[model samples]
Target: MTKTRRIPFVVANWKINKLQSEIAEFLDNVNSKVPSQTVVETGIAAQDLFLADMVRATQDSPIHIVAENVHWEDAGAYTGETSPRALKDIGATYVLIGHFERRKFFNENDSTVNLKVMAALRNGLRPIIDVDEDMSKYAQFMDAEPSVAQVASALAGVSVDQIRNITIAYEPTWAIGSGEAATSEQAQKAAHLIRQTLAKLYSPVIAEQVRILYGGSVTPDNASALLQQPDIDGVLVGTAALDPVKFLELINIAKQPSMPGQFDTDEV
Candidate 1:
């Protein structure tokens, strides 16, 4: 990776937490802590109610605003649903599509994930397509990680340019919020598989350009170890992301130099 290469990306997935006021406070705290010497890109994936609040708070800050979820269609009679256009209009430049919770609780599948991905791109919002493993299939994952089929499906028919602008988060279902996170090596294997799938889907150039993030029990303590991995470009923090101070600590950790000579690596 060169100086002009893809910069490290960090996202805070607030899920169902935070009041509008609290979101403002968190962003204020975070914006203050981001050192002037570093270059880590940051974003907050808050719920629908707080998207505007987050966007307004970070308007002048370097932090990008992201929505936690989105509806596939731009408009219709889908009550209580959020449209990609609405999110973009609200100043959110990114949306989290097909997260594990949506998959498990709301019954989201690859097909819908694809729909949301295209919708986000068309509406000018970058899609953070999440690929997670099902815990029941844990041991089988000893050989298979976030399945190539899963990633390929989410990106089905996506073009190279759009692919380059996108982000993929590999959050193994078993490790998320369970206090038992995947080891850096385990996360690397999964990220490698994702990048491999991307290369095959389009081309090596775009594949390497796409950022693959790890999202599973990420904390300030373990963030540096994970960020230093060759394939891992960033993280999608969950519980820990709720705290502005701790989350900023993780961002600072990401800014620390990747282990000496560790990232002098390329696609396998």
Candidate 2:
């Protein structure tokens, strides 16, 4: 069966930033301006303290409330950890797992990422799994081992049916928060490699059905080129997303249809 085209997903990862008032203002500025989820899906990953409020604020909007992180266990005594169940119950529909920063600073590894992915699925939260790659490996994607290996490991016990809900993000560790973004060609190569990895893990048809995003210093200025990549379904934005106007601009760029010659149905 021919699958429907993947909807562009523009997610803002507000890592440890934004106060309550700021959050409200950001929402107020973008809520009605955001395109419909059907046209271009939008999400905001913020601090746990603000998720419920965000959900409430976007209740009439199509913007999905996203959690920055989630704990593996649904109900656990892991103090300070945000349970997946709690996140779902509080109205968060998506959660970022194994973000490069989390793996680098909080000791989040393949094992923990896998646990959280499954946990989020069990509790009805979509997992936007972030896989960071080295620029050297990304250049010669055929030898890109760590990123592919991380994808395989993260979905270790995930069933084929559950895979449909997964959205893999390719964020090069070197470019994140550095004000340097990868060239569009480089980003496309990385996203294609990730899709190829998905094909190997499941099937080409299933792989084509999956959504892959590129992160690391994505901005309105660079987004059009990046979004033109056939394999790049959307962007996991950072610094630039903090500004509502820029965020809306990025979404508007995504709203534009893919350019001619960008094959959406190319076989894996």
Candidate 3:
């Protein structure tokens, strides 16, 4: 695959944790310290209740507020579901559609995931579509059929123009919250397959342009190796992101220059 200059993105999926008071404290600690988005894009995903507040708190910072999930319809009788339109209106720039937890706990399937992806796009919210691959099966074939299929299904009917606004995250189910992260080589292999899938669905140029992130148990100690992988543009962190200090550390790590051959690019 040819190289491209995709900015590194470090996002924290707070995922149903933190109180209002704790949220305020966390923001106060990291908001002023965050690097400019141009250097390293940063985001924090939290419960729906805290999205608006988080948006306001980070207004002066580069930290983009991300929604964990959004309903397909702009507005409906769907009780307890977040409206994509409302989320956009409330200043959420990004939304996490088809997260592992949402799929595991709330029965989110590929069909529903596609709906949410389209809905988020329709409402001007960029969807960070999560594709959870079961890595234990990775060795059977390097093609990564399940992960590739998930990407195709989630992007069904999405247009080329809209595709630029989307980001794909590969969070292997086995590593998520298990305190074990994929080896750098393993993460790179999965990310490469996802990118290749994009090349087939869209175009090789578009595939290189899209930023793919690695998630599941990412931390400062292990993040550098993962980030240096040619295909991994950034990370979708979980527990480690809960702490303001660790969160800042992750951003700083992303801001560092890539090692030689880590990024091979010519102007797209």
Candidate 4:
């Protein structure tokens, strides 16, 4: 990809960890120490209860606030669930759907995830869809590697417009929180498959424009190597993102150059 074509994003999934006070402090540190905007597009996915505070904290900054999960209904009796409309009303721009933890604990199936994706789009919020990573289950159900093709098929019931508005995050479930990460080769292979699947589902143009992020045990020490992969457009951080200093360091590392011929445009 050309320099002008690069779409680098760094997303922090706060999960259900921080308290309101901790959220304020984290926002303050991120606002005060974040590097120049040219480096990467930054976003934070906070818990539902803290979405308002996060939105308030990032008002005048480039940082975008995102919710970790949202329900398909606009407003309903679904207790303990966040409404997509409410999230949009509070200035949230993105919602993470089908994360590993959500699928594992809440029993979120692909159909439900598809509904949430549609709801996010209807409310004018972008959906960052995490393709479920149960490789063992996937192997039992399919013959080929679960690429973007499978993801597209799962959401085939939706229209092409919704597909365009979505960003695919390729997080291998096994690597998450295991202090292990996909090798550059492994990441490239998966990301390339994602893009290829998009090309087949829609068009090459959309595939080229779509952003694919890597998430799983990512840290400052290993970010540069991962970003060097031509297909790896950005990263979705977890535990490391909890600390301001370490998060900033990971951003800086993502800006460094990789091995010489690794990113040649011709390779794409």
* Cα RMSD for candidates in order: 3.4, 2.5, 2.6, 4.0
lDDT of 3 by residue, 1-268 (tens): 4545678999999988999999999999999999988778999999999899999998999999999999999998999999999999999999999888889999999999999999999999999999996544545656643347789999999998899899999998989999999999999888888887888898777777788999999999999999999889899999999999999999999988762213545434
Runs with alpha carbons beyond 4 Å of true place in candidate 2:
138-147, 259-268
Model 1 residue 230 CA deviation (Å) reads 0.4
lDDT winner between candidates 1 and 2? 2
The C-alpha TM-scores of every prediction are: 0.90, 0.94, 0.93, 0.86
Q: lDDT for every model?
A: 0.81, 0.88, 0.89, 0.77
Q: How would you order the candidates by lDDT, starting with the best? A: 3, 2, 1, 4
Measured by lDDT, the strongest candidate is 3
lDDT of 4 by residue, 119-227 (tens): 8988999989887453334333232434553377446665666666677888898889999998877777777777766766766666666778889999887888888
What candidate 3 gets wrong by more than 4 Å, as runs, is 1-4, 135-147, 259-268
Task: Estimate, for each residue in 61-123, the C-alpha lDDT of model 2 and write its tens digit.
Answer: 999989999999989689999999999889999999999999999999999999999999999
Question: Roughly what TM-score does model 3 have, to 2 decimal places?
Answer: 0.93
Collision count for each candidate, in order: 0, 0, 0, 0
